[model samples]
Target chain A: MLELGPIFRALLRNKIGAILIAVQIAFTMAIIVNAVFIIYDRSQQTKRPSGIDEANTFYINSSGFGDDFDIKGTITRDLEAIRALPGVIDAVQINAIPISGSGWSMGLQTEAGAEHDGQGVAVYMVDEHGIKALDLELLAGENFAKSDIRWRGPAGSKWPAKVIVTEAMAKRLFPELSYSEAVGKTVYINNDEPMIITGIIDKLQAPWVGWDNLDNAMLSPEKMEFQSTRYLIRTVPGMRDQLMKTVEELLAENKSRVIDGMRSIDYVRERSYRGNTAMIKILTTVIVTLTVVTSLGIVGLASFSVNRRKKQIGIRRALGATKASILRYFMVENFLISASGVVLGAALTIALNMLLVSALSIPPLDWFYIPAGMLVLCLVGQAAVFGPAKKATEIAPATATRTV
Target chain B: MLTMTNVKKVFRTDLVETHALRDFNLQVDEGEFVAVTGPSGSGKTTFLNIAGMLETFNEGTYQLDGEDVSHLNDNQRSKLRNEKIGFIFQSYNLIPDLSLFDNVDVPLRYRGFDAKERKKRIEESLDIVGLANRMKHLPSQLSGGQQQRVAIARALAGNPRFLLADEPTGNLDSAMAQSVMELLKEINKKGTTIVMVTHDPQLATQATRNIFVKDGQVSEINDVVAMHVANG
Candidate 1:
């Protein structure tokens, strides 16, 4: 242990410089802790299974141009052609793709005329082959039968009588019941239309990646033919590129409609969470830049201090202090400053995390990150001061005899 | 005891090489108080620095307390200095931030003494300096004479075998310089060997013997009273 009393007294003589360094370290600690938390959260989100065969699947968007074009007929023919193509396993027309950040949502309640708005649930509209195309597992109950499929066109609008809800959605609606018990139960949509739950999927995320309720989703057996129709086509492994080109050409050959877009589900998911990925990148850059700048700041300050105290160092050397003692003096001085900054940073980290939790709805930062951040700062502080401390130890004791 | 034979020190630069000390020889028995006097640039300070082991001589054999120091590395030299030699500077080069007690405690701390031993040495040294009541005062808060006495106390704290003082009273007035010289004489009476370098003739006369240097070589050595009568 060093003599901290003298070290602190020395720092008090240059309180401004020492305080500035401490404050810099505090802010650096705050940013690094929160950035790590956010980065970990976003990367975990990207790693989640989308309940769809994202690697080998692609989607094509088609919109009818003229009134004479038969929209329903074109969708039916397009899906059939896509399914029959080489390397194509299964194809289904969906109202919206999973993890696309764009989908339809409705409120579901256990009873009609309930005063509350009920739980918001993501709604996916597909046919009998939807589960197979998305590779979703049926954990309980049964898949939708072919006869139960309903076609809803522009001429008429009606809700599906049967729906397949994810296990998360089932728990939200009927928390007290088992997954099997949730099946065959009636849930009212818009507090009017009654639909029976036919199946329960193990897991299916919502379109929005960071939503608190991403797993609350349901699938309706309804054939939707909108102005712009979307077809999810799953192909054999390593055949997405070939299948996308073939399907795009096949749809282009028909002049009745225009191909708005065609991309693999992997690309779609990347685009949907582009904001989240960008945030991660930006936070990482800021963290790296802050660490560098803070370290450089410490280096600059220590170098300046060494230059200013050269005579004092010479005197100490003349008084029989070894080179290692002088070196440790400066290092201990820097550690005290860094340790002070870390304490201040812990409080600042809590304050900043509270703001983030309230404004962005992110979870509170984990407790372990604080000590982890402090360790990093301590190491950085010591490394930064080493160069200047070494310089101080080289001062010859003969310097004390000189007038200067 | 201290001994040096044919000591040489050179200061080198890009354009010139200056011989600060050449063929310097000196020997002082234990408990002897010797004063070195010289004109400016005559290398009296260089001699004192070498004697204190603060600087290395390029060519010489030096022995302090029966140990050869000519081949010791920096760490060994520092340990020897801490244990056996004390240094006093013209400017009273006490660390300004530390109190008088802490300033005196520096060499004792370097000696690896425990806290109780260090405290005992510090208090005893301070008491010997006649400023025992001012232990908590910083160097900046004291007069030049007081600061120089504190430096002396610091040198005495380690109970060194010898003390090397480079113009210890150069910055003080006549009264202060006389008091400091008297203190040195008292310390020497207690059997601590002391070597002081100074230009003040009156103060130089107080030591047991005086050596005069000219052009990096010792010109003459004489007893203080005999030199006074010879100059007359």
Candidate 2:
């Protein structure tokens, strides 16, 4: 009601100051929004699923038992021993588990032609019953082979002749191909020899979450060497601690590997969370520091504009204008600066988001953030105006009357 | 109406004390055109500042339109000044960043008038100054005389009880100054009490009454007698 109302005109008056404010706001917003999304994703990764209970599971790095031991024999013997132990519910030997997100990558060049630049897919290898053990769903086709599986290739650097593909990979590699077409397709994976796709499994968990999932390739145990390191053991209620202690006792002679240093799948997943959390904190501190600096810059500029207008303000004051009216005038000017900065910053942020997605290969700017980002900028701009507006009011009308 | 009786204003710094106004007294009845003339350091501006409630005096009994202004706080003083006083300055002091209409509207905004009322007041004020068609033009686009007229319009828009002019025509050429002098005379005849401080002897004599300040106190001399007294 004093001259013009608060919102619209306030931001329209000060152009550069408003842009600086919005840039700061957008900077802070980019970090804050990115941080929140990262946290949410990490939480989703950490959330416990119903099938294989992580809390009641016992895992061991079997390769830690010795440098040159038969991993299969050791795994078979330990699993039996673990199952026989008190409170141990189930023991299974698995070649590789996927939930830790680390999947073994191999080449996938569409046997037709390797045309494009090196874009390769990964293939995961696991022994028999690993799927049932991890409680993963097989969307199409059967699991890996039940008998001995082997691939005789160059330097023996190969997995089994039978494989499984995740649904995402199935879509990418096959697309319109039926399960039966996919089952017999010679997929070039670990062995340099084409292996028949025995099953199609929806991606459960991998070393990374991705749509392409280059490591979406799967290998059965018949193709592996006689050794493996990791073991995923599921147990019944309340027997988790006892089961872990027994595994430690078994590896106690070799000691160091299984001591307090062994990392579980849960630890690995949380490591990713910690990684993103650090990112959030760093980016947030940077954006906040810059926002403070920008706000100070805007307020400084606004103060100058007000000081220069002192005589005019004094004239207005003498002409029956109240201090509140003068205060609103300066504040509205600041709002203009803020609003302009916000709009430009919004566009700038969107442009920056494009670079973030294209160059850095991070996610694009989510549309939901624009309005929220602007709101933050508007608030910051208003704050910048506060000191100067009050100063403008303190100017006396008699100041203009002086022959300056 | 404006009255000042035995007002004293002292300025002090660490160890130096200077008296700007000592035993200053003057009175302006309704509808009087009064000119205050003085040499530098004679305290004419200080008297105006005190009378306009722009500066505080160390000791005084001062009243404006029947209210005691000598003891008013900053806000109260501001309220009194806004409600009762209008000003025309030598420099015009028009807002460089605002248009003519907006410049006139600035004071009315302080008075908290609605848009329709403020617009009407602004147009009428500009019309009185013969610049109604040029309301959208900036002060920079106007000549000094025109800008000064806008300043007058600014003061007039508020419709204050009294008008204060500090060297209002000092910046204008002689021909423009006479026109402005005529404008002031006409405004005075319309019943707006005007207190003008001028250095021009001719302009000072044009007022109905004149006061000359010497050193730190008021000195009385006839309009013609004052010039000869200063010149001699």
Candidate 3:
């Protein structure tokens, strides 16, 4: 039988230590739950697919410096040579790589005029071979034809009439229509320039992984006529590393151009999400450290309580308390304290989550984390108090008769 | 109601072996109030502890209410102790944080009585000890005599077959000690057996029988009286 009534009354009289430990537990729970939630949230974000064959693709930047360097000619020649290599599948000169953390964005509206509300979209400048070179699955509409490809000079301002948008971008632009139905729709870029949505790709992330509209992107059918360009190359399975070296060497053969910043999509992704990875590691350490410190605090308090009540425990033992009963007594007492702490912790968890949601604009915490944290902390408390409580049982029943 | 035959208790340390009890023998019938007196280190307390089942005896055949308890496990001993034995300590060992009622409720709780039955027993025992009205007061709020009375109430709450008290009135004044002695006599009159160990010969004279212990064995009354006179 549990002596809950007597133990509770006893705690009521001597509660300063229990209250301090309980408050410590409450604060630890609040921080741990929130930190775990943030870690989960960030890890999920880092796992989002960038809609490319990341394992078999890479990109390299080439900049020609002298007057004899042919920007357009060199790009065209380099594409032909790279595509014709043994392991190369397809290649395209892209303006920006997906999830690379830097790119161009523009506003597209359904109707004309600057006063009309528009949605933001990251812009990828690729030619007719963009779909195969980037491994994009065209969900609806047709791919761009060779004749549809346009060349834009450094001083050019004309917008392409045909553009392909990702399914997410199509949904944002025309929420009333399905992705397939939005294929032939016309959207106005730069407020008034008419651009028709020629196709819808299944999934593609924008250049900025941290953006709220990470999946909202459009592919314009254009090749740059500038001094610097990046070539996105996709190789056959198990051939990316070999092709990366070959392509870098081939591009380096051009004396007027410098080949630099050659990287695979995997490296780009790692660099992009480094902040999130660091945050996860730091929060995990904090949670572990807080749990250890809180457990130690519980051990300290329980050991002190047992030491102070040695004579009382002996008297109880002499009165007929079995070892198991004595063990249960301390366990139940710790449970009551932990239960109170977790109850307060639940409120604090939700409150902290609310503040984070308002301040950081992240989603509100999931409801299940509160209960899970409470149970874990309770188990930790019970485990921590076991050693001291067991020591209490070792006190001789004869201690009650000792005058000292 | 209680018997011990050739009980031996040896206290061994790294460098010393002290015999607390050797070839100890004692028997007390039901409803008898027996007082044991001895000088310091005479093993009087050790005998009380062994009799109460608080400490185990080596090389002994012990019977309490006709049950052989020499080979009982610790848990079995604890159950028998809880069900059949009551103890009062020299210091009036009431848990300081618990009120009179709650302190008295400790053994009954271990006895597995329900709340109503426990409450009834607690009130009745406290009434017997003349502290029922002060049941809600903490032990620290009471005087020394009142605390000892609370301890007695706790011992009587379970209605055990025997009470083992080690110097029950050792910490009280003369008036309080006499009052507690009268209470014990009244309890003995009600047919509960009691075995008390004390150093006070005046207190020992009031028991139905008095036994003196010297050098871990019970000695004669004349020898204890002569030793008492010599010490004085």
Candidate 4:
């Protein structure tokens, strides 16, 4: 039989130790729940796909230094050499690599005026081979033909007449139309320069992983005539590392240019999300440490309670309480304390989560974490109290008759 | 009814094995009030503990109400003790945190009685001890004599057939002692078998039978009060 009423009243009379342990449990639950949620959120962020072929792809930069570096002719020759390699799938000279933390952005509007609001998008300058080199699926329209490619000088201001967009950017630009229907639609960049949506790709991420519109991007068919150029290359399976070394050595052979910033997509992704990984590790440590401290607090309180009530326990045993009953008594007593702690902890968890949402701009926590935390903390309390309660059962009933 | 034959209890340590009881024997019929008196280190408490099943004897054949309890497990012994025996300690042994009603309800809870039945028995027992009106008062709020009465009420609430008391009035003044003695006598008159262990010879004379314990053995005596007076 459970002695809940008697145990509660007893706790009320002696509230100091019980209250301290309860508060410890409450604080521990609050911190642990929120910390676990944060860790999970960070892990999910790190696990999200960047919508690129990260495993078999890499990128390198070529910054020509001499006066007559032949930027356009050199880019053409470099593309031909890379594509003609044995294991090379495709290659393109792009203005920026996706998820590489450096890129260009522009806003587009359906209406041709500054008075209308526009959606933001990351811009990638590439030639006809952009989709194939980046391993993208042309979901809604045909890929760019070679005749559509154009060349612009360093200070050129002319805009391309046609552009291809990711499905995410297409949806944002034309929410009322399906992505396939939006393929031939016209949108204006730079407030009035009209650009037609020539095609739509299935998925692609922005260069900045932390952007709210991470998947909003567009590919413009243009070759750059500048002092530096970046080349994106995709190799067949198990050929990327050998190709990366070969390409770096080949680019370095030309004395007019320096080969630097040669990195794989995997390395780029890791460097991009390093902060989130560190946060997850730190929060996991915090959760574990807090749970251990709270469990120890429960054990300390229960052990002291048992030592103080040795005589009472003996009296209960003499009054015909079995060892099981004595064990039940203490266990049930600790349960009551744990129940109170979890109740208070629920409120504290929500309050802390609210503060985090407002201060850190994180999304609101899912509702189930509160109850899950409560159940876990209660189990911890019960397990921690078991050893002391068992020791209490070993007290002899003859202790009741002993004067000292 | 209770009987013990050649009961042997020894306390052992690393270097010593002291005999607390050796070849002790006793018998008490139904409806008898027996007082056991002895000096310090005489094993009176040890014998009472064994009879109450609070301690197991090393070698003995004991029977309580026709059941051989020598080989009972701890759980079985607890059940038998709950169903058959009640104990009153010298210190009253009331859980100080609980009210009089809750203290009285403890033993009945172990007996697995329903709440309504337990309530009825607790009220009736406390009324017998004249503490029913103060059932909600904590034990610390009561006097030593009143606390002992609560202990007696706790014992009686379970409706056991046998009662074992160790120095029931040891902490009381003479007036309170006499009052408790009269209460014990009244309980005995109602056909409850009781065995009381005490150092007070005057109190022992109040029982229908007196047995003196010396050096772990017993001898029946009829004039304990006179013997105590003569020794003084």
Q: Which candidate comes out best when scored by DockQ?
A: 4
Q: After superposition, how far is residue A190 of candidate 3 from its true place, in Å?
A: 0.8
Chain A TM-scores, per candidate, are 0.95, 0.72, 0.98, 0.97
Best by TM-score: 3
iRMSD, per candidate, in listed order: 1.5, 3.2, 0.7, 0.7
The TM-score of predicted model 2 comes to 0.74
Residue pairs of candidate 3 with colliding backbone atoms: none
Q: Give lDDT tens digits, candidate 3, residues A281-400.
A: 999999999999999999999999999989988888899998899899999999989988999989998998999999988789899999999999999999999999999999888777
> Deviation in angstroms for A323 in model 3?
0.6
Ranking by lDDT: 3, 4, 1, 2
Stretches off by above 4 angstroms in model 2 are A2-58, A64-73, A80-92, A97-99, A104-204, A210-225, A233-249, A252-261, A273-275, A350-366, B71-73, B221-232
Model 2 lDDT per residue over A1-404, tens place: 44554234334444454565556655655555554444445455445342345566656764433566554455556656766777665555544444555555555544634443322455444556566555566877787665744433225665556777666566567768864567667666532556677777655545554434533545455433344455666667676667677767876554323444344445655564565657666766766676688678768887887776777677766665567767877777666656666676677767766766787666665677777777776777778778888988988767877766
Per-residue alpha-carbon lDDT of model 4 for A278-331, expressed as tens digits?
Answer: 888889888888888888888888899999999999888889999999999989
* DockQ, ranked from best to worst: 4, 3, 1, 2
Query: Candidate 4, residues B1-232: lDDT per residue as tens digits?
Result: 8999999999999999989998889998898888999998999999999998989999979999998899999999888888899898999999988989999999999999999999999999999999999999999999999999999999998988978999999999999999999999899899899999999988998987899998888866554446557766
Point out the higher-scoring one by DockQ: 1 or 4: 4
lDDT of 1: 0.89
* Residues B1-232 of candidate 3: C-alpha lDDT, one tens digit per residue: 8888988999999999999999888888898888999999999999998888889888777899999999998888888998888898889999999999999999999899999999999999999999999999999999999999999999999998989999999999999999999999899899889999999989997887788998888785433334556776
DockQ for the candidates, in order: 0.66, 0.37, 0.79, 0.81
Lowest lDDT 10-residue stretch of candidate 2 chain A: A112-121
